[model samples]
Target chain A: MHVLRPLYVVLALAVIMLIARSFWVPNDFGTHEQGYTYGWYRQSNVEEWKNFTVKYRGKEFCGTCHAGQAQKLASAHHKDIECENCHGPALFHPADPLKLVLDRSRELCLRCHTSLFYPTSQRSQIKGINPDQHNLGLECTLCHKPHEASKPGRRNR
Target chain B: MNRRDFIKLAMKGTAVVVLAKGLDGIFRPSDVQALATPLRFVFLVDTYKCIGCGFCVKACKLENEIPFDADVSRTWVERYVVTSEGEVFADTPKEARNGFITGQIDLGRGKFKDIPREKIKKAFFVPKLCNQCEKPSCVQVCPVGATYQNADGVVLVDRKWCIGCGYCIMACPYGMRFFHPVHHVADKCNFCYHRINHGLRPACVQACPTGARQIGNIKDHGDPVENIIRTQQVAVHKPEYGTNPQVYYIGLGEEVR
Candidate 1:
């Protein structure tokens, strides 16, 4: 009888909790919106998820201001390439448009055009040239244009 | 009460307890309607196309607000170089900064020591992220219902509900789950759920220079992922575990884990 008394109390507590849960649990809780988890958790996760502030605003963002450059890039072989890829990230462009520095260095071009150590099948084949043999000391921009580095004897777009 | 009467009462109590256990299934959340359709999300990583540039790692870190710590990265690139003698050296440098070629191999267990490249066989870069499994072990083990999978099959952790018990971290077979250094809660990749829900690619995919990483819904026949899966031989990591990982690999060699 003594053991049964505690069992009865436990049963009563269990029944009360079950009833309270039905009332306390949100209607949408454990539903599809919450993925059948705790109801309050769904609400919390939704509120926590916020749009991340975009840092690299692709070519589309750059094209908004520099329409002429955007138009030129569209017709060139480098049309698909992003402006920030070469010019560097312009996070504060509109506020400080001067921040977009022009990288006319030969190393910048070699980063992609150089004969990389990677296998021929893997690395992109753009006329692979040994930097030491071709230009020696001359700048890449001196002979090849930055925007459209077309093949030899090909007409620039 | 008499001994016989007490036994009868105990039997009745046991029966009620058994019935109560069965009732939980009846009370399961009806929101399973969210998964009514066979929604499929495919993440394809082309090992051949990756150049080990680590731009994707940089982009993911910036976009996700992850601190600049080598150990706390959400996504990382591993470079595997095989030797002529069949020796394999695998290493992941600090964000693959100077590329995958320049890193020492000391992961405590000394899995693969650094070997000089003169006797090289073949080298490749493998990028890794959370699998977003269909039957996520993390979701099944979460006692507080913190980890869950959405209707579209993206596994996510409810940060607020997480009890920091570290069960999900241990449950994940891919070793993708990590206790967030700052938040002190279990965190892993959700395929950029915040961005994908808004029709944007994940930061890593967007930042990839070689178009090595591709993600799309396989449910839509018109989607490129569906065509790729049909045309190319796609594979998931550790299929024997039966986690049903959504991430697929293209050009995955036998050497890769």
Candidate 2:
């Protein structure tokens, strides 16, 4: 009778633990494959991460509405660059703001155009200018059309 | 049978049932195991080709909605200036969002000094992001089970579940994790999970003017990024830690850690 008392107590504790686990742990917990290796997290969290909204919708998304600008950009030297790189992310554009903001600051242009003298680097191949000597206060867009780099004219905008 | 004998028989049966259940949990064929093909994503960084334009950094900020002025960034470029006297100086001014220019280097904590051009033996830029290790220490140390690696090998954080304990942040050997100011959760790079799954390149990869950053499915032999990983001589940061980082770096300099 004395030995059975400890066994009954252990059985009661096991029942309590089972009930607590059922209430505390989420139903979807440990729902993934290899749960032993990859700590058992709620599987639904994977979908939560996957469903995150993407703000920068690439050039293809832009081409759907602005076909002319897209075509002009494709043939230009800046074709390799995405539209969002210069114009900012088109998050819900043409609906929320009705316009995408363009960063036409001289600093934006100088990021890649400023002459960085690296003798061994391929960066030297890029057409760069001494920002101070070229045009101190004037914006690069005043003379250079970024989308159409070869064509030098004041941007209409 | 006597009452004691009957109880003993029932106990033996229950033990066998519990052992079978435990074995089943260990060996059960889950969805990933049942799949014909599993995806493995890998990233490649060509340090030689990276011109330190900082466009990727800028693009990453805009795409991920990280504040431009924030002290932390998902990706950043480090400039290594190796002096003639064999001293290596590294710095990332403003997280390299405003490209590296010839000026005084702002080593963090109010330390600023200019490394004269003549004294520099070599200089180059190395861009870094979350390595998404095969056996990630961050995932191992998350006490709340909020950080986990997906089947595709991208480690992600459950923002809702994370208690902001910062354990994952500390456990990360690469120092990739950071506390998100707005969300108050531990945030690190997920390789732009939303974009890659939609058949589009990550914002940083697309914004790279010189094609320095590349990502692709390593499981696919046809992938260009995977081909480079297979044939090229590449290296990862801190192989001694044995994190098995998925990000491969080409033209990795000896000066870089």
What Cα-based lDDT does every candidate model obtain?
0.70, 0.83
Tens digit per residue, CA lDDT, model 2, B1-257: 99999999999999999998877667544433554445888899998788888889998887787788998889999888777899888889898998775445677898987777688777778999999998889988888778888778899889888999999888888888999988999998899988888888888998888899999888998999999999989999998898999999998898887
Regions of model 2 farther than 4 Å from truth: A1-21, A151-157, B1-37, B101-103
lDDT of residue B210 for candidate 1: 79
CAPRI band of model 2? acceptable
Cα lDDT tens digits, model 1, A66-149, are 888888777766664567656755666778556776667665556445543444126434444566686677777776765664
lDDT tens readout by residue for model 1, B1-257: 99999999999999999888666544444332343555666798998888776767766776676766647777888777777899776677674533433334545454546455366567777889999887788888888777787656678787767889999899889889888888888888877777777777887887776788989987888888878987889998888899999889897777877
lDDT of 1 at B164: 95
Model 2 chain B scores worst on lDDT over the 10 consecutive residues at: B28-37
In model 2, the Cα lDDT at residue A93 comes to: 86
Measured as a fraction from 0 to 1, the native contacts recovered by model 1 come to 0.14
TM-score for candidate 1, please give it.
0.73
DockQ for all candidate structures vs. native: 0.22, 0.33
